[model samples]
Target: MKNILKYMSLAFVGGIIFASCEKSRPVVYTGENFVAFEDTLLSIPESSAKEDANGETQAIPSIATIRINRGSGDISKDLVVSYSVKAKYVTTDTLGNEVILGDVPEGNFYLSSPGAVTIKAGEGFAFITVTVVDNDQTDGNKKLTFTIESTSDASFTIGYPGPDKKAKSMVLYIEDDDCPLDINDFVGTLKVEDVAIVSTPLEHSYLVTSTQVSPNSISILGLFDPVTRYPSPTPCPAPVVLVFNTATKDVIFSPTTQTAYYRSGGCPATTNPRVVYPDPAVPNKFNTCQKLFTLNYYVRNPSASGPFDFVYSTVSKP
Candidate 1:
């Protein structure tokens, strides 16, 4: 009787362990269902570049990626999705910003394949290509919009709408390539007039000879030609480099260090001269015709604790 009781207890413990193991096992679903991987559907911007010389717009390629999620493991079935768009897909907001159907210009943008895209078995995503045309038109902003219509898989859904409407439709804005202000456009000799140094205005004349150092930058030479005859007899000349921003005809000056020298009797010695500093507060400005640029920010004389009240402007530029 004792042996039978012990055997019965062992059997009960084994059964309990087996039942717990069974309950912890994961359940697998054999049915197939697909969903969009992204909360929103959108395409990357395809840009049309303008010609270097004539500013003519050129056709460029833009691509948008569409990904799908299959609940079931890789299957031997092809998932096909159809996309459609109409004129109503394109609209402008109160701010004049336009949102168009497709990728910038769905109907107008050139495409190799127009309609349906397929997601092959074992693959969960596909790419959609949109053609961007540069017609040299700068009238206003343009756009293209693309939306998923129907899928071949009955259990598959197009998109999941989230807080942002981007999940349902993809909109691409076609930016205009309009740049009237470039470094080359403003290259020439700029005269410096009404010069002031260290709070004392003086009748001094200087010229800033601007030469194109690069496509986007210009080298401004002869900044200290009519050197300020201040506490020193000889002042060192320093050239400043400037970069041109097209959107705003703004010329940004690069920070540089200049040396202020005093004549040492006859032949100049190899010793280093006094240092001239750039003002931390002042920044140069430029526009279409009327422009204000800093040749040298804060120029200090030898033995002076602070910078001289220095200001220079472009008298003329061609």
Candidate 2:
């Protein structure tokens, strides 16, 4: 009787250890990329792009999305299942800032809902995972909304099948949208006075060389001339030095930043003219346009982040 009792205790301890190891088993969800492996953060072109004068509204990609994998590890018959998805971006910046990279959306993707994993009654661990979207819609009221959601849930192991290998299949699933934005009805007479720096291949895009600031939407200054001296060399009516916030889209006539104020100056007269600052989007690099400003421009963005910068988009008086 003593021997039997000792043997039973040993079996119990062994069973407990096995159970603990079993609980810590990793669920391998085999997944693939949309096009390339690096496509984890795949970028789409502009949902809507318009050609100038003769230009028409054309399509450009601009959505980013992904899929999840659920493997049928050594299982036979399909097992009942549910799954949850989680995803993240590679960069520290929030998902949308016009200049910052964008996010993935489900509206234009073909991610399926989760279902069951198949396995025999004696079979163990068969998982099926599908699609999840982490969408950061670029720019929203100057604040970005980075969201990720799952179309499924994780599953529980039912039983175990005889040891055998299995494989699962996956495919790309993203489609372009017809009208993601209000680019259809809201047409403003934008005097695309100037197209400033959008890309600088050889420099950091966050520094401004020289910034001029004053009051009254000073962010619209587009002068290609030099600031004059006062006293003996004073220019007529004293030119109002214009200033702008290349970041934050802030503008002020008196040196405030990112506020949209009606430009109040022009070249020569320098009054009531739009102001364009040195390109802060790219530092240590010079843009072809020495001057940048828009006239008769109308922007339909409910928020102020949207600026009109089409080249020759509007007829210029000068």
- Quantify all predictions' global Cα lDDT against the true fold: 0.47, 0.25
Off by over 4 Å in 2: 1-61, 65-237, 246-250, 255-291, 295-318
User: Which TM-score value belongs to model 1?
Assistant: 0.36
What ranges in model 1 sit over 4 Å off? 1-178, 197-199, 203-205, 225-236, 245-250, 256-280, 288-296, 301-304
- C-alpha RMSD in Å of predicted model 2 compared with the true structure: 19.9
Give one digit per residue, the lDDT tens place, for model 1 in 139-179: 33443445667778777645653444234456544444432
The residue-level lDDT of candidate 1 at 243 comes to 71
Worst 10 residues of 2 by lDDT: 1-10
Q: What is the Å distance of residue 58 in model 2 from its true position?
A: 6.5
Give the per-residue lDDT of model 2 (tens digit) for 104-131.
3422222223333233333332222222
